[model samples]
Target: MDFLNYAFMQRALVSALLVGITAPAVGIYLVQRRQALMGDGIGHVAMTGVGLGFLLSTSPVWMATAVAVLGSVLMELIRWYGKTRGDIALAMLFYGGMAGGVMLINLAGGSNANLSSYLFGSLSTVSQPEMTAICVLAAFVLLVTLGLRRQLFAVSQDEEFARVTGLPVRALNLLTAVTAAVTVTVAMRVVGLLLVSALMVVPVAAAQQLSRSFTATFAIAVAIGVTVTVSGTITSYYQYVPPGATIVLLTIGAFLVLTALATPLARRRARAAAAARPAGDPAECSIPATRGATDEVGV
Candidate 1:
């Protein structure tokens, strides 16, 4: 209880909660669409922006946010350009962004700027203002995700169908990309650029294994994300491990357990349903009758 009185702890908790909610909310769609690696690319871009901020003596958050958004737009543009060759484009963007970030960091003489904080994460550095900013951003993200849920769902499930249905597929894709950028930027505070993408992906992956519906999957993912954040933060505080690594490990562990437990049950249920169907329904009987008629006609 005494630990809760510390301002740093409080801020860390608030930031974690905000990040836990928003990251997984956006991540569910990303995971379904096979764009999980996109977050990692954007996070690296945000890291480059952080270096830029240091070079300019400005707020790292602002710079990182702007860079991440731009990176997202760039990713969407590349995807559009590649069209049928999107995977190659995404790979190019990821490696390109990573190289750019490393170069910028080295050029800025930020070698002593505790870059590791943005790599593995450090909860001790979370401040009050950052927490407030994270809360506001989280709220905005939540509203946007909920407001555009239908379009996002359509695009995630079948982008071609979404295009056919006149859903502004391009615009929606850009929006989702921008959302991923912001999510990565904000998550950097908690998990750092290197590991923030994991926070966006692992929880949703774990929940997907256990959940039967999209909504249920999202709810469970958020729950798992929050639990991992809180538990990891606390353990890291006590054990002196990196919070980001701890959180990521916890998420992975949960995912493995969920996958192992759910696979057998899902298969069993499917087998049972298959067995329960009537063996000689009208449709099945008609198939043989039709075949018999064809055979007689051959005579």
Candidate 2:
């Protein structure tokens, strides 16, 4: 409670809350498409932008967003055109982006220590400009994720079907990727680039264990995300721990707890389903042996 008195903590909490809401919102789509790790790839690519920002003496948040968007677009194109060798291309992109960041940051006269905060998050250090940027980015993310849910769902669940339904599959895919990249930047300060994927993915996974529908899963995941983030941020403030690591650990804890609770829920649903099933003729009927056949041939 006392920590909230400080302006820095206030900013940190606001950013953490926003990150909680937005990360899982966009992440559910990625999980639907079986591309849960795409957030990690975008995080890697955004590193170069962070470095470039430092070199150019600009805001890393916006720079990382620009660079991440381009990288995500390229990744999407590779998915389209490089189906067979896409993994290799993505590998190169991830590592190249990371290496470029290291090199550029060196050139910018900054050391690894300077990048430590961005790499692993330092919510307490967020400045007024960065806070403004985070708010704007979060608004855009919420608009895309919530406002266009049905269209994004159609594309992510089945691209070919979405195309057949005239849903602008390509545009939607690009938008999802771009939105995911922006989410990476939005969460960069709260969870750090390295751990942002966990915020994006773990809550969704946890939610899926207990949900029967996409809508339920989405709602549950957002709830779990918000729970862990706010709690973790406060814990970090008191414990003097790394906020990113603390938040990620708490998310994992929520995942495990939900997973354990899912077993009984699943069994309850199964029993209910069995009871509600319509009774009908058995597929295989047992016929009694004929009287004549019952007599053994002893000859």
Candidate 3:
């Protein structure tokens, strides 16, 4: 209880809550779409925004938000342009953004004040204003995700099918990119630009192994994120470890344990299905079928 009384602790907790909710909510969709790396790309783009903010002596969060949004949109456009090889497009954007950010930081005389914090994360420095911004962003992200859940899910499953079915695939893809940008911006403070990808990807990855339903997977992912945030903060406070690293490590550990637990069960299910197949079934054995009115097939 006394720990809650501290301003820094309270700020950290609020930041954690906001980040945990936003990241996992957005991440479930990212993971489904196989665009998990996109989060890391946007985070790098956000560093450019932070650097610009530093150069202009303005609010880094706002700058990061704007840059992240632009970057997200650009990524979607690139993905569309490189439709057949979107992964290459994404990698190009990620590396280009990272290089641009570094250049901006260097050009700005490299003030280490907020840069390092953004690089490695510093929960101890979270301020009231930043916490408020995180809360607002989190609420907005949740609302948008919920409102577009169906469209997002459809597009994620099959964009071509969705387009053929008259769904607004382009608009949905843009909306998802925007939502991802906002999520990355909100999470940047908690995990930093360097490691924010872990926060976005790890929990969801772990949850997917344990959950069979979409809703169940989303819920478990959020739970895992929140747990990592809270536990990481506490560990950082007592053990003097870096918060971002701690959170990432905890997330990785959870993923490993969950994967280990799921593997045997998954294997058993596979074995059972294999055993259930009818013996001597030509279809099961991949044998060619005989033509109509042809001789009886002999194995």
Candidate 4:
């Protein structure tokens, strides 16, 4: 109730909600594909975009979005051409982006920018224009993600099989990379560059650990992402801490809890399932371990 009284807090809450929803939705794909930390690489690349924006005296959010999206596409193009290890590509992008951003910021004489705010988010720093950008950008991310769900799922589940089945695997990868870039930038608003990957990865990781079904995993991941983000934002509003770091801590905590309970949860589920089955009817009572995972992880 007290939080609702303040305009900034309201804005922060709205921004948190929007980012919370979209970031982890994209994360579900990344996690299933074992590319959960891809956001970290893209976040680094986005800083160059931020630096470029300052140099051009334009809106940093849009500039960062454009650059990050381009960087993501370039990454896909690299994969298509280089056939190098994904980790190697991300490693190069990570270092290059950091160096480029530093050089550009120095070149533009924009050192006055509060770099910490971008590295670790500050809810207080969100302006009306930035909020509007977040809204529009998040909407675009969600729409595209939802629209391309089938192709994205097929590619993530198994590009080789998808290609064999006549799906445009390369084109789908490019589209996914672009969408993931948008999501990384959106998450950057709520969690900042350093921790945005956590927001994208942790919730999905937790959900996957706990649920065998991709549907359940997706649903639970969204719930955890939204709940943790909103709670962290509210707490930060009262505590005067950085909202991004606080939200990240919440995500980390959730991930740890889920991890700790995963084995026990699996055992319990197994027991319950066993009890539900007739002693002589193993065929009727057995649940396939790969049921929902087949589509998500290509199991």
TM-scores for all predictions: 0.88, 0.93, 0.87, 0.88
Off by over 4 Å in 1: 84-92, 282-299
Candidates ranked by lDDT: 2, 3, 4, 1
lDDT of 2 by residue, 133-194 (tens): 99999999999999999999999999889999999899999999999999999999999999
Model 3 bad stretches (over 4 Å): 83-92, 267-299
Candidate 2 lDDT at 238 equals 93
Could you tell me how far off, in angstroms, the CA of residue 276 lies in candidate 4 after the best superposition? 4.4
Clashing pairs in 4: none
Q: Give the per-residue lDDT digits (tens) of candidate 1, residues 1-299.
A: 56688889888877777778889889988998998877888887787787777777777777888888988998889878978887777777667766766677677777745577776666778876667767777787788777898889999999999999999999989989888888887788888889888888999989988878888988999999999988888887788888888888999999999999999989998899878889875434434534554475542
Candidates' lDDT values, in order?
A: 0.82, 0.94, 0.85, 0.83
Assess the local accuracy of residue 9 in candidate 1 as a C-alpha lDDT between 0 and 100: 82
Candidate achieving the largest TM-score: 2
Residue 205 in candidate 2, Cα distance off native in Å: 0.3
After the best TM-score superposition of candidate 2, give how far the Cα of residue 289 lies from its true spot, in angstroms.
30
**Best candidate (score: lDDT):** 2
After superposing candidate 2 on the true structure, give the runs of residues whose Cα lies further than 4 Å from its correct spot: 281-299
Model 4 is weakest, by summed lDDT over 10 consecutive residues, at 290-299
**lDDT tens digits by residue: candidate 3, 77-115:** 988897888777777777777777777877888766657
